[model samples]
Target: VRNNGGGHANHSFFWKVMSPNGGGEPEGALREAIENAFGSFEEFKKQFSEAALGRFGSGWAWLVVSNGNLEILSTPNQDSPLSQGKTPILGIDVWEHAYYLLRQNRRAEYVEAFFNVINWEQVAKNLEDASS
Candidate 1:
C-alpha cells in the first residue's frame, strides 16, 4: 500500500520539480537557505550528487526541509522523507528506468544532468510552504 502510494506521490513531485527551461542558480530566500545549509550551491550540488551516486541501488536523493532547516537525504526503494516527518523540497530518482536509456551505467552523468533541468522557482515555493 505504502509503496504504491509513495511511488505515485514521488513521481508527481518529481515531474513538477523539473522543466526544460530550468537550471542555473536560485535567487532570493531560496538561494540564501541553500548557501546557509550547504555553504554554497556548488557544494550542495556536489553533496547531493554524491548522495545520488552513492545510493546502493534503486533509490532517490532529496533536499528536504526538517525542523525549519534544509537537509540532503537518500532513501532506498520507494520510501519518502515524509515518512520521517521531513518535507521534500527537491528530489531525484536514481532508478535505472530513470536513466538507463540515456546514461547507460554512468549514474554520475545522469545525476549531473539533473541540475540542467531543476525547477528552482518551484523548489523555492516548496521551501516556503515547508517553512510555513
Candidate 2:
C-alpha cells in the first residue's frame, strides 16, 4: 500500500510540477533558498543530476525542504520523501519507464530535458506552502 500510494503521489506531483512554458531560473524566495543551499542554480542542477544518476536503479531524485532547508535525495522505486517527514518541492522520475521511450538508454538526456519543463512558480508555491 505504501509503495502504491507513493507511486501515485510521485507521478501526480511530477505532472503538476512541470509545464510546457516552464524552464528558467526560479524567482523570489525559492531562488534564494536554492542558492542558499546550493551556492548557485547551476550547482544545484549538477547535484540534482548527480543524485539521479547515483540512485543505482529505478527510482526518483528529489529536491525537498528539510527542516526549513532544501535538500536533494534519491529514493528507490516509488518511495517518497513524505514518508521521511520531508516536503518534496521538485523531483525527477529516473525510472526507465519514465523516459526510455524518448531518450532510450541516455538517462542524462532525459535529465537535461527535464530542466526545460520545470514549473518554477509551482515550486515557489510549494516552498511557501511547506514553510508555512
Candidate 3:
C-alpha cells in the first residue's frame, strides 16, 4: 500500500513534468546544467529515453539533481529518488497504465511523445529547489 502511494506520488510529478506544448531544448540554467552534466541536451535526452525504455517493469525514469550534478536513473516499481536522498527534477512513467491509454503497447512512441510535453520551466524550478 505504501508502495502504491509512492507510485502515485511519482506518477503525479511525472504528469506535471510534461505539457502539450513542451518539446525542444531546455533554456536558462537548466540548459547550462544539462550541458555541464551531460555534455549536451541531446545527450541528456538520449540517456533519459534509454533509462525510461530499459526499466524491466512498471517504474519511472528520472532526471535527478544530486550532489550538484544531474543524473539519469530508473526506479523500479514505486521507488523514487526521494527514497535515495536525491531530488527528482524530471520523471517519466514507464508503467503500462501511464501510456496504454494513449499509445497502447508502444512504449517507445510514448517515450517520444514525452518531449512534446516536457515542462522545462517546472523542471528548472525543481532544479533550483533541489540545489537550494
TM-score of each: 0.98, 0.98, 0.94
* Local distance difference test scores for all models: 0.95, 0.94, 0.90
Which of 2 and 3 is ahead in TM-score? 2
Per-residue C-alpha lDDT of model 1 across residues 48-91, encoded as one tens digit per residue: 99999999989899999999999999999889999999999999
Question: Which residues of candidate 1, in runs, are more than 4 Å off?
Answer: none
lDDT per residue (tens digit) for residues 1-132 in model 3 = 659789778878887888888878789999999999999888998999999999988988999988889999999989999888988999998989988988889999999888888989999999999998
Q: How much lDDT does candidate 2 score?
A: 0.94
Ranking by TM-score: 1, 2, 3
Candidate 1 weakest ten by summed lDDT = 1-10
Q: Mind giving the per-residue lDDT tens digits that candidate 2 earns over 70-105?
A: 999999999999989999999899999999998899
Each candidate's number of clashing pairs is: 0, 0, 2
| Weakest lDDT window of 10 consecutive positions for candidate 2 | 1-10
